[model samples]
Target: MELRQLQYFVKVAKKQHMTQAAEELRVAQSAVSRQIRHLEEELGVRLFVQKGRNLQLTPAGSLFLSRAEHILTDLERAVGEVREFLDPEAGEIRVGFPHSVSVSILPAFISCFKKEHPNVKFRLKQGTYTSLIRDVTEGEIDLAIISPCPETHELVKGEVMLTEELLAVLPPNHALAGCKSIRLEQLKEEPFVMFGEQYSLRPIVMNACLKAGFVPKIEFEGDETDTIRGLVAAGMGVSLLPELALRYSTHIEPCVVKVDPKVTRTVGIIRRRDEKLPPVTELFGRFLMEFQPSADPGRPMDRLDGA
Candidate 1:
């Protein structure tokens, strides 16, 4: 019901031992237990169920724990925002990047941003683009660098960062190895090794194939681009990967074929549409959209979703 109660609940939920939580909070065990009991009675739902000396959350308790953590996190963020509003240059911004973006232009972007905002520390979180969007929308991250905008809710899209193509990475000895360009139709029959359904790339790859008139026969799936490329080189199956996905490899010798000018990816910034822009977040978003010297800008993407 209160901030202090939520803090105690979080500490106890983490330790699953009231005595330990009280020790960590530097309070009497009875005081911690009393507050927890008061919270449970007020909500008319138990937050944790005890089993002898050990502790664990019931199904209801588990769900409540997640909500409690979020409530506490939101409060902390609200306080931090107020404090930062008073002293703009002194707070940390938690930024999340797609796994793909971290390898590409992010290094330069981070270096450049740090030079300008040395007092501002960045806490980096990495995940796929879909997850990044969800985190940013939920106030988990101040800004997210992700692939092209889709029909997402409560997100503000910034300038396009870079346009990229979906390249087919084929093994050196594959039949299409020497080909400079391969159409989506040509790859319709090839076995594909792709990221799982959770990745944004999977939807794009599947849509491309469905447009080409065949369903992709996904033979293997992985979360990492390098792993997928390695699978390709080992003669497992070919993969559709973006430029950012290919940044960390030297071992796999795969021929990357541009899926033509029709199929490309665009990177952009995503922030919560509901939230007022803090100066740091707004500045970082623009800094992210700036062109990098080595960015291999791809062809125009006006017709990317066309069949």
Candidate 2:
């Protein structure tokens, strides 16, 4: 099928309205209909079904839509790589990051980079590690900062930036609050507040607890690291979070305790393995490679007041 046909199909699938899709595509309504029909015929599957006056994607259409979007995104990246090769200093860099890294790492990096390359722009997408990885693989983002990289196919490349230790956070009144360090086994019966299962840190916490001989009793889950810390401070449950995440909890700071086994997560940069990175993305990656966390003592998390 033609690339234009796939583009038309994706727009139609997203809008689910022929006239609206055509208007957005800046084409005549009949052209959108004709292209979609041709795509369906080539694939030997009906892409859309009529329900009253509105259009909806059929099961086959839904599946095709994902592939169509991926193809278009890859095509856009291919064009971007060529354009950036010609104009190395100008272009937008799309980056994905989780909340923990956003609070601690991104602000300083962006500030320093902007001073050197004022024309470079950034489009930031904040999400869990899993979503960030998906976005990188799907070509939605040029690079991502994620922790504890998961096993993947040859389509993704990861370069470790640093391994940061995690600390146990407990309510001020909890028995473990006074301890300098506690073991995973000590939290066996304690109610736990944790990142949502979709995040990479959730699995790391669970596996660490499991290795210590008991499953953690997760009592609450949240998408933001600060919210989870708030729950801990409210005496809802205890949790293990990256030290950087602790900076966001200053308002209702939980007592931070070191973990006995010294749990740590590898924070790193990731990009598509087979794709050629744009000039701006490559430069940012090099900056990340040369970054030294210890050199930046101004990071809020470094205070560790409640530890």
Per-residue CA lDDT of model 2 for 91-116, tens digit only, reads 88999998888988788678777878
Error of 2 at 124 (Å): 1.6
Instruction: Give the per-residue lDDT digits (tens) of candidate 1, residues 1-307.
Output: 7878889988998998989999999999999999998998998988788888857777877888889888887778778878778876767777888767776567767776777788877889998877887787777788887776554564655456677778889987888888878777887778899988888888888887888788989999998777888888889988889866675556766777777536677777777776766666666776665544353333111112231
lDDT of 2 at 60: 94
Where in model 2 is the C-alpha error above 4 Å? Answer: 1-9, 30-51, 55-71, 295-297, 300-307
The best candidate in terms of lDDT: 2
- Model 1: lDDT of residue 211: 84
User: Which residue runs of candidate 1 sit more than 4 Å off their true CA positions?
Assistant: 1-3, 13-15, 34-51, 54-71, 154-160, 247-249, 292-307
